[model samples]
Target: MAVRGFLRGIGGKNAMPQGASADGSERPLKPIAMGDGATRLQLLDEFEAGGIGWFWATDDQNRLIYLSPAAAANFQVSHEELIGRPLTSLFTLENGEDEEAAERPLPFLISARTKFANMTVKVDAGGDPRWWTISGKPYQDANGVFLGYRGGAKDITADFERQRDNTRAAHFDSLTGLANRNRMTRRLTAILTAYKAAKRSCALLMLDLDRFKAVNDTLGHPAGDELLKQVAQRLERIVGPKGEIGRLGGDEFQVILPDIDDRGDLGELAHRIIQMISQPYSLDGSRAIIGTSVGIAVAPYDGIEPSDLVKSADLALYAAKGGGRGQYRFYSNDLKDSAQQRREIEEDLRDALSRGELRMYYQPVVCSQTHKVKGFEALMRWEHPERGPISPAVFIPIAEDSNLIIALGEWAMRQACEDAAKWPADMTVSVNVSAQQFSTDSLPALVTNALASSGLKPRRLELEITESVFMGDAATTDAMFAKLKKIGVRLALDDFGTGYSSLGYLRKAPFDKIKIDQSFVRGSTEDDNSNSAIIAAIVSLADALDMETTAEGVEAMDELALVKKRGATLIQGFIFSRAVPQEEVLEKLADGNFVYEPNGPEKQRSQRRTLFRRIGVIHEDHRYEAVLRNLSRTGAMIEGLLEVPVGTDLVLDLGEGQLAICRVRRSQDATQGVEFETPLISDGADGLCTRHRISPYALAAAGMPLAALPPGHYAMPDRRGARPTDNRRFMQVDVGMGASRAA
Candidate 1:
């Protein structure tokens, strides 16, 4: 409608309002025939004054021409003050305030000279937000000359706010107010997509709470929820603005760290997370204790896609759990194999309890001054049907994950106590307690059962628990200690200052002994290590607390001397004795003497182990059979080589592709000691091997394209046959069974 059709003129004659009529003229204000035009205008004006809807108009320039009295009052401005103001000054399209309406519609529609209807935009009053759904139509005269725009607006502030809240609820976890899994998934996908193009790095940390189910089962669901909220708060504090943390349902969480890939930094972060989460939580005044395992994966390195990255991180997490809870692991390509092996081990461990395959070996812990054994620490050993001896390192964590640790713990306790009953009355048996087993409520009952069944006094049984045991409910831990102490068993803190190290635990927990971990003992005798100082401090601390200190993993005489000088009250290491079977222990004790002679190298050095395996020694043309009596990083002693002169070069075929090129340094009748050309390196376990193997590329040139050398003796084709001339350097001789060597 033209502006003239809507507004009456000021003169008695009906004149066109500004920019209204087609011609600059007015119609005579003749007396109404049927309907009264003036009266109708009055009624429309009254309706516009009502507050139901607001009427507004703007000129071609978008400046306000007129606003209904009601609309003016709502903006707290009079009509005269609002009239010449720009329309855009009153309203703007929401800047992402609504998912549907992203930008202002008025300018675009007006610029196109088109009509618009029910376009919602944000209107401002003071500083509060007000929403309005405005409908407008552009006006033109009969000549098609543009006039202005007229519109009516309805407030939609309530509806708009409600929708925003609903969207928020949908994207966030209700209990924790952290991003839910759905939001996390989208966020990760988006970040990975963008980061890949930019070649930037991101790290994702996957974390799962350890022993959370026990807390839920013990404290009920409400308490569990409260604990989760507390955990979210802690994560937020740790992560802060550096990353985004999301609760991935239940006890799992995901943290997205941008622009970080250094493993050392990630490791430190993982450690802090482990420590922070392991701290006790107060749930409704009843303490809840739990730990978390972290697995970290980085972008463009571990994965370029979100799903793959998550899977990689998950594998690392599984590895962390398999390595025992409360630790972190970075994703490695080998983790897939490890995870599969862990599954298989878990399955095998279930049947192990019934298969009679589990056994215990005891390592003597001796008094340093007297060299008399005070007690034995029981170490669990498992032998698979086909795998032969499976390391405790590989199987114990599998048992823990399979929820079989409690059973294993109970059985070990019973067996150790039973075995100790047959030992000398002065000897004690100390058994290790897993974190899962230590947190069990039935632990004291199991101990009582073991003691009663074996008819052994409680004092003869020692319980070794690690620092992880203190990670649970404080009251529960304290009570368990009280109960065990009341039963007359001694409590020892194992591997102190190596894992979860905190002097505070020593002050509160009633421990009778502190076992210095091997990590501190391994290099303590060297000048470049702090292990010696650490040992001294630990010994001093233990003495001040009226606790005994035991130095573990002393491998050399110098280590022994260092530990002794540091005031270790007791020592448990290979220097004293490797863990021995109970029968052998009985045999040694039958002599009525408990003293052990420390028979080792006069001068301390790296590990030199005694062995008695026959190997082939090749010299020039012939291979001689000899026994490797002792092996070390630098040299070895071989027996059964007759009259070999010093400075002779020989190659000893150590099985499994290892060929030691050595020069005879010392010679004697049927015994010659040889030093290796290149020192051996650790094979990542409790073993050593050649650092550089024969290259497969070289072997390929030799017409053997396999990955490694075959297990037997080999030599290059030569003119000399098996029986060489007397001038030839060597000859082959077989050392038959029972290590009887012939050279």
Candidate 2:
């Protein structure tokens, strides 16, 4: 059958069905079939209208029997020009590889009769290689001669180029043109894994610029940006190919070295980085220099995980910066321990403040001349349930470094003020102020607030500060001190002699009192001319300034006497008492003996004694019948077996209470010490009285009778086994009317 019309050989008109069915209805109509040539023409028209590129070739040859206009357009040629041309002719040999000839056959292409095959073919265009995808299928007439294949070709050069660009952008840093963090992380992971497997080591260095903020603030951001770029470039040069450098952001950078022979190599690199960055950099015609502090965490030495290693490096970096800038530090176990401890302490401090675990103790500072309590120094005391008492020496510095000192100082001030409100109206309370506390602008406000809240008079509160507090900017210190002083709060230069005591500052700044350093007090009476001179000078300076001086750590009578002679008006030390707790302070107050008593005969005697003569009393008192409680040349404390009347004149009885004469020093309780009217008889002859009128004969008579006296009447021999005995049996004595006896 043949169909020639557009309607496929349809009838010229609506023709009646050839077969008729029942009820006058047409049963069906048979359509005519088209020829193979007609079918082929229809497919070609569809392909051409759809803009699809097509090619048909036989396995026997690479030549194309049919080619669509779209396919020819891909080759920049007309359909007629490519219709009989071989497919290989469209693509030039890339890389000079040989191409199949048009007459040759491809076995793989010949076997594919129904299925389509796809392949990439390289095409040359203007000396540049372009890629294309070629899809084709073998075709043949049914039970007849073999026909060529037919498929499509699409250009993929742009897709390939886009892919290549994406890869490059993913792995590199665009700014410094070095590997980005992502690439460095991946490389580090692989390197670490390899190192672990091989049992090797490596190091990671983290560095941050020191005082970079100051530079950035003084200069412009643009200068800072340029400096960073230059730093990155310098780092790259230093690291070269041996290691990888990466900027973690801002002024922080990191370096990773694999298979490091020694950790020192990293240290050397760090030192170099510090030195190089520390060199002056010109920014906007002005030279700026900045240092770098580096931290190094070595693999297998610091940690196994990348994050852990980085954390250690960061901790070490902080340590370097904290230990003063321009240094490098290695990660150590102790550093981790200290870090952990600090974190714990910070947490504990917060909890402690909330839990009200902190308290203050008061030590009374008294007036030496008036013997009246004038003030109390507030000392911080921590009583932990498990740790017992923790010293401020251990935690105060820590608090300052962690910035907890501000809060702690505020708390302490409030507490001291509250306690001061409870103290005697005339007694002031002084609290030590830390240097860090002074740094804050709110310190004066804090003091004012504390006073207002506690309802305590500002005049009743004193602030104790060390010399170091004023060692900073002169103007700043002066301003701060002036403001504080204007508030009616007394200021005392604490530990005055220990620090840079520039008396000029003392003169300029208005201080109400100077507390002599304990160090000077501890050694002032050692008979050292230098110490004595220092004490004298301090006292003189205080006098010249019309400032009250309080001598601290006066542990002995000589120290007290020396400070007194130097005209120190106030004294604090173990000689009187230690810094007792609040409860104990009242008890010490009740016991009032610590108050200096100038009129007291015992005290007067103690002050007049020389150190050498004080020791002599213990040697000579074998059975002089006295227990030397406290001794001095001019006066001594003797607790005797016999009670001496308070106003009695008595002989000191240096030799068996017979030769030496002394008036009965005012007796307190049962203790008595007499001042010798004359030097004791030291003559080797049997009981010769050198000064006192008692003769050797009288000593012999008294010794014999005292031997029979009751134990209560005489003092027992001391541990040295010396008993009161009359060696005067060999001599005679002369009694005089001026001589008086104590026993």
Say which candidate scores most in lDDT.
1
Candidate 1 lDDT tens digits, 503-613? 767887889999999989887877888888999999999999999988988777888898899999998888778998889888988898898778656555767789988
RMSD of each: 13.0, 29.7
Residue 632 C-alpha lDDT in model 2: 35
lDDT of each: 0.79, 0.63
TM-score of 1: 0.65
Off by over 4 Å in 2: 1-346, 586-743
In lDDT terms, how accurate is model 2?
0.63
* Candidate 1 Cα errors over 4 Å, as ranges: 1-155, 368-372, 439-442, 453-455, 467-479, 495-510, 516-544, 551-568, 574-578, 583-743
Best by TM-score: 1
- Name the lDDT value of residue 279 in candidate 1: 75
Compared with the true structure, the alpha-carbon lDDT of candidate 1 equals 0.79
Residue 100 shift from truth in candidate 2, angstroms:
70
